[model samples]
Target: MLITKGYFYNRESHVNCQALKDAWVTLLSRYHWDWFCTFTFRGEILHPEKASKTFDTLLCKINRALFGR
Candidate 1:
């Protein structure tokens, strides 16, 4: 199985990474609004990569919950 931002896509399919990033941003904004806004609005919040990883984890968990192993 191929995983992108924790969402699995067929390896043969050309999945856009931007779509996964967008999904991550949406997921954070929707479920973690306070942190999302804080991190977004805060100046010098120098951990975007970390946040991206977190988003990936969240997406993975969500995917597992929705689709199972």
Candidate 2:
């Protein structure tokens, strides 16, 4: 089963970062029984460096939440 949620965030837009994080955590946890999982982000990232850092941080948060790391 594939679950999808969309949110737009940019310099001109307001988005709840924590809410987005929580949603991803919940989705991943709820589907923990699956043997494999993949996540894809399709959009243009204006700042590659900043986006990379954010992505790394989010991945760490997810890992800690799901694996107790």
Candidate 3:
């Protein structure tokens, strides 16, 4: 069985993307399964372009860790 959870933040909230990335990587590393899973995040980013870059980096890291690319 696979379990998935999502976290959302409002526009006025202050979010540390690096901290979030670290937490997610740690969680993924700790409890990863062979079955495919998806992670969806919904929140307000103060800088969409910057956040996009960060998320892209996060995705690459995740793929490399999970798939050994």
What digit string (tens of lDDT, one per residue) describes model 2 on residues 1-69? 222345546667655666778978988887647466464566854477776787898989989999995
Give me the runs in candidate 3 sitting further than 4 Å from their true place: 1-45
* TM-score of every prediction relative to native: 0.35, 0.34, 0.34
Overall lDDT per candidate, in order of appearance: 0.68, 0.69, 0.69
| Candidate number with the higher TM-score (1 or 2) | 1
Lowest lDDT sum, 10 consecutive residues, model 1, at 32-41
Each candidate: RMSD = 15.4, 13.5, 14.0
For residues 1-69, could you state the per-residue lDDT of candidate 3 as single tens digits? 222243335556544566678888898898858886464556854477776787789989989999997
lDDT of 1 at 36: 26
TM-score of 3: 0.34
